[model samples]
Target: MSTLGMVDLQVNGFGGIDFNKDDLTAEELDHALTAMLATGVTRCLPTIITAHTECLRARLRALDSAICNSRLGPVMIDGIHIEGPFLSAKDGYAGCHPKDAMRLPSIENFDYLTEGLRTPIAMMTLAPEHDGSTQFIRELISRGTTVSLGHTRATRDQILQAIEAGATMSTHLGNGIAHMLEKNNNPLFAQLGEDRLIAGLIADGVHVPPYMLQSWIRAKQASRVALVTDATAAAAARPGTYTLGDVTIERGTDGIVREPGSPYLAGSGVTLDQCVRNIMNWHGYDLATTFCMARNTPLSVLGKSAIPSVGDIAECVFWQQHDAQWHVTGARIGNWQVHINS
Candidate 1:
């Protein structure tokens, strides 16, 4: 059946190409986009998590150059998702992000990181409880950037304040936190209760359990939920060790990516299409509804429109389900049509 082309707003890497690197090349970026397209993702925002200031700058420059030089341009690489350097420095909550690189949120720092970059900074993931984060979130919203709260130890009140200050979403709502938290009060529950905020959930099954995923969807409602891969370079690659930012993570035979000898997840090794299938099987959602959560919800949060009802030139994907897996058979991305070999 045909579905609206998927949009991934928080992809770090795929097809063995890590976007969170200082040495990312234009060709490698093109190959990554190709890999994503082969899996039915028509557009995406490449996410860069916590890193050194200069490193982030260099990476942003490289991505901007790649987008400018790419044949796909905006159709493939729509924007950038800056995930950190402004997250919680607390243990467990920080995940695999380098603590030394973490910093308090500031508009000046954001400006320095994004300076001279043509690619739009579509979204940012930051801890709301950090000093100056409220103003920074407001400023980012004013400048047309979508701000998301994540990697945080913020209290319920703090989250509400961030939402009041213009934070519109939660980045990977259930991940990026410690193993233990108080049952009633936590970032996850706080975000789930906020009707004004949309939540991005990594439905790769490894990031969140099926029951928990179902609970999150029920709390946030299907319309307020968006599926994200939160994928790392190990995604679509063979099981082995991979690097994200400077941390070494092992993708075991079970397909779970995590820090060596630690239970902390590094990132997901699943594609967005697989995430869609997992969500469908876990939640018993139909193809159209699942596509809405995978595609339209994210576009809505970014202030973009959904697919046209009566357009021949619409971006779309042709896929079929077999053995509980969704496979892309063909796709029309922008003006281009891609056919996959069976």
Candidate 2:
């Protein structure tokens, strides 16, 4: 069997690096990319959460330079995933993002936030219930940007409308919600039933329970499910307190990251490599099927080729399962060959 390189579409920060911060240097960005590479993520989109306008611009510019300068190499930073400032302002739905920064979805504001950046914005996560969001989704799709519905309180009708308007994915389904929800009428069920939307799941076993994860996979099927880590700065860092944007979060020994003194999760501490293992263990999937969910599904949704054509020498990762755990023992990216167990 041929190996497949993993791709992560929704990652905020990793290896003690926060992409939303204003002072993020190129060196720190390089370090974060290297950490991701170690975990078998050959391609990724660095996600930026909700923040002030100027702050967002600064961060975007810094990231643009980091990619253009070859700080992490040519193919590591495939694109950028802008997650907020256009999301719902509801309490639990907003998660740890600054409530004051939330805004109605608009292309003008998006243009302002991403001004003068040469890096392509691959996807944007927003609340589709907001006025003009449907049109905004169409506009983004026109410009070759994928729109994902998330951080929302949309009705079932609104979700369908977003899908009709070219929203093709969901950011971290089963998350960005309050502990309590209306039993039947909710975004979770609405998204699950929509076959057009490719759902992103964080299978760290903490974000979404095993039963719910199994249900989502069954509902959406493996082909339409993309596994993402949604990892924060705490990932690959020591287990302790760390900052995600402006919020302080603590990573416990259990490997779950949460807001200080609260049960609400800040983000994930697990890497994508760990997510693959968890999903396989939870669902009893074969290694090939698991890799397709993590790699092919996301690449297809992002309008990228899922695999190398016949006679092409594509970069890939070789994995070995031991004691019910999956490990990336080697990887080849273009001319680069990385050996993990040598």
Where is model 2 more than 4 Å wrong at Cα? Answer: 309-314
**Residue 290 of model 1, lDDT score:** 88
Clash count for candidate 2 is: 0
Cα lDDT of all candidates, in order?
A: 0.86, 0.87
Quote the lDDT for 75 in model 2.
67
lDDT, candidate 1, at 335: 71
Model 2 Cα lDDT, one tens digit per residue, 1-342: 237689999888999887777777778887887788778888899998998889888888887887777656456777899999889899879988899999898888899989898999999999999999989999999999999988888889999999999999999998997678788888888998899999999999888999989988999999999999999999988889988878888998888899978888998899988989988888999888988988999999899888678865467787877786778887766665677773
Report lDDT (Cα) of residue 152, candidate 1.
91
**Residue 51 in candidate 1 has what lDDT?**
87
Candidate 1 local lDDT, 231-255, one digit each (tens): 8898888898888878888888988
TM-score per candidate: 0.95, 0.95
